[model samples]
Target: MVKPVIAERGGAAAGDDARNGERAASVRWALAGLSLCVLLPSLGISVANVALPTLADAFGAPFQDVQWIVLSYLLAITSLIVGAGRLGDLAGRRRLLLGGIALFTLASALCGAAPTLWLLVAARAAQGVGAAVMMALAMALVAGTVPASRVGGAMGLLGTMSAVGTALGPSLGGGLIAGFGWRAIFLAGLPLGLLAFALARRHLPADRREDRDGTTGGTADGTARGRAGFDGLGTLLLALTLAAYALAMTMGRGAFGPLTLALLLAAACGAGLFLRVEANAASPLIRPAMLRDPALGRGLAANALVSTVMMATLVVGPFHLSHALGLDTGPAGLALSAGPLAAALAGVPAGRLTDRFGARRMTVAGLAGMAAGTVLLSGLPAALGAALGVAGYLAPLVVVTIGYALFQTANNTAVMTGVRPDQRGLTSGLLNLARNLGLVTGASAMGAVFAAAAGDVATAGAEAVASGTRATFAVAAGLIAAALAVTVAGRRARPGQTADGA
Candidate 1:
C-alpha cells in the first residue's frame, strides 16, 4: 500500500512539471507573435517613406499629393489609438489584436491594388487604423503576459524588433522598388501579417481579468464585465482635434492663410470639448487622474520629445543625402539605415540597463546623446567638402540611434510598469498617441523650417538644401535639449520613483 501511494505521488508531481513547462512555452510563443505584430507596421511605415518618390512618379502626382500617403496614416492613428485601447481593455486584448492584424493585412492588399492616388491614400488610412489597434494593445499584452521581473526585458525585445524592422525597411523597399515596383512595398506586408495572426491565435491566452474573489469576473476592481460602451462623442471630438491639428500643421508650411488659422482654432475647440467629455464620462476613454501621476506624465512628455527629434531627422536626412550628396535612391536608403541599425543593436542591452539602473538615468543619458548628435549634424553642411564629411554624417546617426534605443526602452518600461494592470490599455494608447502626434508635429515643423531656409529648391539648388538641413538639425537639437532639461527636472522632483513595479 505504501509503495503504491509513493508511485502515484511521483507521477502527479511529474505531470505538474510538464504542464508548467508547456505554459512557459506558450507564453514565449505569444510574446514572439506580439513582437512580429509590432514589427510589421513599423517596417511598413519606413518602407513607404522610401518609396514616396516612386509612388509620385507612378501615380503622376505632385509632391504635395504624394505627401498625403504618409499624412493620412498618421492622422488615422492619432485619432483612433486611444479609443481602440479602451475597447481592448473592456473587450479581450487578444481579440482586438487578432482583429487588427486581419484588418491591416487586408488593408495592405487593398493599398497594393489601388490604381489611383486617392484610393491608395484611403487604403493607407485603413492600414493606420489597424496599426493603431495593434500598437495600443501590444504593451498591455506584454505587461499581462510576462512576469513582473521580466517585463523590462520583454519590452526591450519588442523595442529591438521594432528598430530592426525600421532599419531593414528602407533597404528592403529600395530593393523591391528597384526589382519590382512601388506596389511591392504594400504587398510585402501580407505574408508577415498573416503569420503573426496565426501565431497569436494559437498561442495567446484568453482574457484573464482578476476580480475580488481572484476569479475572472467580479465587481471587486470596479470594472464592469462584458463590453465596455464605446465613447462615440469623445472619439469624434478627439478625432476632430487631431485631424484639424495635422491638417493645419501640414498645410500651414506651404501657405499661412485663413484656412490654417481656422483649422488651428478648430483643433483647439475640439481639444477643449474632448477634455470636457472625458472629465464627465462615467467610463472615461482617458482617466484624468492617471495623467497627473508624475512618472506617467513626465515619461510621456519625454517620449513625445524624443519622437519629435527622431522624426525630424528622418524626414530631413533623406533629402540631404540625395539632393546635397548626390546619392542614388538605393545608396541614400542604405545610408539612412545606419541610425535604426544602431538602435536595433542597442535596444535589448538598453532594456537590461534600464532594469539594472533606474529609468530616469537611462532617459537622461539618452536625451543628452541625442542633443549631442543633433548639434554635430547641424555642422555637417560646412564639412561637406572635407574628407571626413561622410564620416561626420554617419557618426551622428549612430549616436542618435543609440540614444533613441536606450530612451525608448527605458521610458516605455517605466510608463507601462507605473500604471495599474487595468489601465495598461489606456496607457499604451496614450503613449502611442504622444508618439504619433510628435511625428506629425515634427515633420510639419521641420518641413516648414526647411522650406523657409531653402526657398524654392529649383532655384536655390544644393546650397539651399544644405542650408535648410543645417537649420533643421539646429532646431532639432534645441528641442531635444529642452526635453532633456524637463526630464532632469522631473527626476529631481521625484527622487524615489522607479520602473520596476509593473
Candidate 2:
C-alpha cells in the first residue's frame, strides 16, 4: 500500500510540473501577441510618412492639405488615449483590446477604399482611436501577464517591437507603394490586425466580472477601485487641451504664427482648468497625486524631451542625406533607417540590462549617452561629410537611438513598476501621450530650426543643408540635456524612494 501511494504522489507531481510549463508557454505566446499589437500602432505612425508624396499625387491634393492625413491620425491618438485607457479600466481591458483591434482593422479597410483624401484622413483618425485603445491597454496588461521579476524584460520586448515596426515602416511601405499603389499600404494592416486579434482572443485572460456596485475588487484589498462612473468633464478638458496643443504645433508648416500663439494660450488655459477639475472631481481620470510623484512625473517629462531629441534625427536626417550628401531618395531612406534599426537591436538587451542592473542606473546612463551623441551629431556630419558622408551622420545617430532604446526601456520599466494595478492603463496612456506630444512638437520645432539655419532651403546648396543639420542637432542636444537634468533632479528630490519611486 505504501509503495502504491508513493508512485501515485510522483505521478501527481509530474502532472503539476507539466501544467506549470504549459502555463509559462501560454504567457510567452500572449506576450508575442501583445508585442504585435504595440507594433501595429507604431507601424502606422511611420508608414504614413513615407506615403505622403504618393498620397498627394493620387488624391490630387496639395502637400499642405494632404498633411492632414498624418496630422489627423496623430491628433486623434493624442486627444483620446487617456479616455480610452480610463474606459478600458472601467469596462474590461481584454474586451476593449479586442474591440480596438477589430476597429483598427475595419478602419484600415475604409482607408484603402476611400475615394477622397478627406475620407482617407477621416478613416485614419478612426484608426488612431483604435490604436489609442490598443496602446493604452497593451502596457497595462503586461503587469498581469508576466512574473514581476521579468517586467523589465517584457517592457523591453515591447519597446523592441515598437522600434522594429517604426523601422520597418518606410521600407515596407515603399515596396507596397511601388508594386500595388498607395491603397495597399493601408490594406496591408488587415492581416496583421487579424493575427493580433486571434492571438489575444486565444491567450489573454478574461476580465473578472465587476461587482454589482460597479467596482473591480483588488487582490490586495477588497476595497473598491476604478470608480463606477466615468469622469466625462476631465476627459473632455484633456481632449480639448491636447487637440489645441497638437494643432498649434502642427498646423502652421513650421511657422509660429498668430494662430499658433492663440492655440498655445488656449491649451495652457485648458490645462489649468483640467488640473482644477481633476482635483475637485469625485473620480478623476488622472489622479493629481500621480503626476506629483517625483519618479513618475520626471519620467514622463524625460520621455517627452528624449522623444523630441530623437525626432530631430528624422526631421533633420533626410535634408542632410539628400541635399547635403547629394544622395537619392532611396539612399536617404536607407540612411534614415539606421536609427530605428539600432533602436530595435538595442531594445531587448537594454531591457535585460535594466532588469539585471536597475532601471534608475540604466536610465541615467542612457540619457548621458544620448546627450553625448546629440552633441556630436550637431557638427560631426557636416564636418566629416566631405569624406565620410553618410557614415558620419549615421554613426552618431545610431549611438543616439541605441541610447534611446535603453532610456525608453529603463524609463518605462521604472514608471510602470510602481503604478497601482488599477491605474496602469491611465498611466500607460499618459506615457504614450507624452511621447506623441514630443514627436509632434519636435517635427515643427526642429524643422523650423533646420529651415532657419539653412535659409532659403528651397534653393539651398549641399553646404547649406549640412549647416542646417548642424544647427538642428545643436538644439536637439540642448533638449536631451534638459531631459537629463530633469531625471537627476527627480532622483535627488526623492532620495528615500526606490527607483520605481511612485
Candidate 3:
C-alpha cells in the first residue's frame, strides 16, 4: 500500500512539471505576438524615413509634397491613439488587436500599390490608425497576459523589440530599396502583419464580458452617466487640438510665421473646448480626474520630457557629425545608428533591471544617467572634441541612449502597473501621445534653436555647428532635469505601487 501511494505522488509531480513547462511556453508565444504587433509599426515609422527621397523621385513630386507621406502617418497616430485605446477598452483588446493587424496589413498593401503621392499618403494614414490601436493596446494587455511579478520583464521585452524595429528600419529599407524599389519597403510588412494577426488570434487571452459600467476586459472606461457610446465629439475636439499643435510645430520647418501663431491659438482654444465638453459629457473620452492622478499624470509628463531630449539627439546628431566632425554621409549614417543600436541592445536588460530593482530606484538611476550624459555633451570642450573625434560624441551619446532605455522601461512600468483595468488603454494612449507630441515638439523646436544659433546652416562654420550642438544639448539637459523632478515629485506623492514594478 505504501509503495502504491509513493508511485502516485511521483506521477502527479511529473505531470505538474509538464503543465508548468507548457504554461511558460504559452506565455512566450503570447509575448511574441504582442512584440510583432509593436515591431511592425515601429518599422513603418523608421523605414519610411529612409525612403523619402526615393518616394520623391517615384512620384515626381517636390520634397514638400512627398514629406506629407510621413507627416500624415505621424499625425494620424498621434490624433487617433487615445480614441483607439478607448475603443479597444470598450470592444475587447484581443478582437480589436486582430482587427488592427488586419487593417495594417491591408493598408500596407494599399501603400505599396498607390500610384500617386496623395494616395500613398492616404494609405499611410490608414496604416497609422492601425498602429495607434496596436501601440495603445500592447501595454494595456500586459497585465492580463503576463504574471504581475514579471511585468517589467515583459515591458522590457516589448521595448527591446520596438528598439530593434527602429534600429533595423533604415538599413532594412535601404537594402530592400536597392534590390526591389521603394514599394518593397512598405510591402515587406504584409507577411509580418499576417503572422501577428494569426498569433494574436491563437495566443492572446480571450476577452471576458464586461458590465455596462465600463469595467471591462480590454482597457479604458466608456461609461456615460451609466450608458455606453463612443465620445465622438470629445475625440474630435482633442484631435483638432493635437493636429493644430502638430502643424504649428512642423510647418515651415525651422521658421515660424503668422500661420504658426494662428495654429497655436487654435490649439489653445480647442483644448479649452475639449476640457469643457468632457466635464459634462455622459461618456467623456478621458476623465479629467484621471489626469489628476499623480502616477498617470506625472508619468506622462516625465515621458514627454524625456522623449523631447531624445529627439533632440536625432535632430542634432547628423548636423553635428557632418559639419563639426567633417564626417561623410556614409560614416555619419553609421554613427547615427549607434544610438538606436544601444537602445535596442540595452532595452531588455534595462527592463529586467527595473524588475530586479524597484521602478523608483531604476527611474532615478536612468534619469540621473541621462542628466550626466547630456551635461557632458553640452560642456565637452571643442579641443576635446577635436582630440577625441567621433569617440567624444559617441561615448556620451551611448550613455544617454542606455539611460533612456532604462528610464523608459521604468517609467512605462510605473505608469501601467497602477492603472485601473478600466483605464489601461486610455492611459497607454496618453503615454504614447505624450511621447509623440514630445518628438514633434523637439523636432521643430530644437531644429529652430539649432538654426537660430548656427545662423544659416549652409554657411555656418564648424565652430558654429559645434556651438549649435552644445546649445541644443544644454537645453536637452534641462529637459531631462525637469523630467527627473517630475519623477521625484510623483514618487514622493505616492510612495509605493501594488508591486515593486521590476
Candidate 4:
C-alpha cells in the first residue's frame, strides 16, 4: 500500500510539471505575436526609405516634398505616442493594440491607392498615428506579461525582430519596387497587419489597469475599470510644439526665410506652453517627477541622439549608393541592408549580455562603437576607391549596427526597469516619442546637408554626390561623438549604478 501511494504522488507531480510547460509555451507564442506587431511597423519605415526616390519619380515631386513622405509618418508618431500610451494605461493595451493594427491596415491600403503625392503623405501620417499606438503599448505589454527575471531576454527578442524587420526592408522593398512598383511597399503591410491583429486578439491577455493601491483596477470577474478622462489640451499643445519644431527643421536649410522664423517662434512658444500645461494638469500627459529622474532623462536624450545618427545614415546611405557609386536600386538596397542585418544578429546576444553583466557597461561600450563607426564612415568616399573599398564601407556599417543593437537592448531594459509598473506605458510612449522625434530631426538635418553639398540629387553628378555623402557622414560622426560624451557624463553623474541607475 505504501509503494502504490508513492507512485501515485510521483505521477501527480509529473502531470503538474507538464501543464506548466504547456503554459510557458503558450506565453512564448503570445510574445512572438507581439514581436510580429513590432516588426511590421519598423519594416514599413525602412522599406519606405528605399522607395522614396521611386515615389518622387512617380509623383513628379521634388526631393523636399518627397522627404515629407518619411517625415509625416515620424511627425505623427512623435506627436501622438505619449497620448496613445496614456490611453493604453487607462483602457487596455490589448484593446489599443488591436485597434492600432486595424487602423494601420486601413491606412496602408489607402497609402497604396493614393493617386496624389499629398494624399499619400496624408495616408502616411495616419499610418504613423496607428504605429504610435502600437509602439507605446508594445514594451508595456511585454513587461506586464513576462516575469521580471526574463524581461531583458524578452526585450532582446523583440529587439531582434525589430532589427530583422529593418534588415529585410531595403532588400525586399528594392526587389518589390524593381519587379512590381513602389506601391508594393505600402501594400505589403496590409496582410502582415491583419494577421498580427488576429493573432494578438486571440493570444494576448486582457490586462487591466493597475490602481494606485497596488491592485488591479478590475471587478471580481476581471472586467476593466472605467476609463480615465483624456487630456485634450495637453495633447494639442504637445502636437503643436512638435509640428512647429519639425516644420522649422525641415525648412531651415532651404531659403532661411520668414516662414522658418515664424515656425521657430511657434515652436518656442508652444514648448513653453506645453510645459506649463503639463505641470498644472490634474492628469498630466507626462509626469514631471519622471522627467526629473536623471536616468530616464539622460536615457531619453541618448536614445534620441542615437536615433538621429542611425536615421541620418539610413536616409543618406541609399542616395550615396545609387548616385555616387552608380549602383542600381537593387544593389543600393542590398548595401543599405548590411547594418540592420548586423544589428539583427547582435540583438539577442546583446540582450543576454545586458542581463548577465549590466546595462550601464553595455550602453557605454555601444556608444563608443557608434562613435568609432561614424568616424570611419566619414572617410568612406576616399576609402571606397581603394583596393578594399567595399570592405572599408561595409565594415563601419557593421560596427555601427552592432553598437546600435547593444545600446538599444541595454538602454531599453534600463528605461523599462527604472520606472514603476504602473508607469511602464507612459515610459514606453516617451521612449518611442524620442525615437520618432530623432528620425524626423535627423532626416531633416541630414537631408539639408546633402542638398547643400550636392546642389541637387536629380541633377547632381557623381563627384557632387560623393562630396555630399562624405560631408553628411562627417556631421553624423560629430553627432555620435556628442552622444558618446553625454553617455559618459551621465555615467559619471551616477556612479556604481547600471544604465537605469537602479
Q: Between the candidate structures 3 and 4, which one is better when assessed by lDDT?
A: 3
Error of 4 at 11 (Å): 3.4
Best by lDDT: 3
Which 10 residues in a row give candidate 1 its minimum summed lDDT? Answer: 211-220
Residue lDDT tens for model 4, 170-263: 7788888999898889998988888888778877877664612134356334756443456789988988898888777766754467998899
Give every collision pair in model 1: none
Sort by TM-score, top down from the best? 3, 2, 1, 4
RMSD in order of candidates: 3.9, 3.1, 2.7, 5.0
**Collision count for each candidate, in order:** 0, 0, 5, 0
| Superposed model 4: Cα runs more than 4 Å off | 49-71, 112-122, 177-184, 211-228, 251-255, 319-330, 379-387, 449-474, 492-502
Tens digits of per-residue lDDT, candidate 1, 1-502, equal: 9998999999999999999999899889998899988898788678898889999899898999998898788778888898888778777688888999999999999999998999999999999999989888888888778876777778888899988888888788889999988889999899989989998999987876640112244333576644346677888788889899888877776466999889989999989988999887755676677777777788788888889888877878877777777779878867887888888889889878877776667778788888888888887755563356556678887998899888888788877876666678778899888887787788777788887887776676666788888898888888898888777777643334443322
- Candidate 3, residue 203: the lDDT equals 82
* Ten contiguous residues minimizing lDDT sum, candidate 2: 211-220
Give the lDDT of residue 95 in candidate 1.
Answer: 89
Indicate the TM-score of model 1.
0.87
What is the per-residue lDDT of model 3 for residues 1-502, given as tens digits with 9 covering 90 to 100?
Answer: 9998999999999999999998888888899999998899899999999999999888889988988898898888888899988888778888888998899999999999998889999999999999989998998888788998788888888888888998899999999999999999999999999889988898888876551126423324543245557899999999989988988887846577889989999999999999999988877898777877877888899899998899899989999999999999999999999999999888889878888897878988999999999999999888889789999999999999999999988888888877767677888889889999999999988898888877778889988989998999999999999999988877753445443443
Please list the residue runs of candidate 3 whose C-alpha ends up more than 4 Å from where it truly belongs after superposition.
210-225, 493-502
Q: Against the unseen true structure, what C-alpha lDDT does each candidate score?
A: 0.82, 0.87, 0.87, 0.80
Candidate 1 ranges with C-alpha deviation above 4 Å: 1-17, 53-66, 211-228, 322-329, 379-387, 453-470, 492-502
Model 4 poorest 10 in a row by lDDT: 211-220
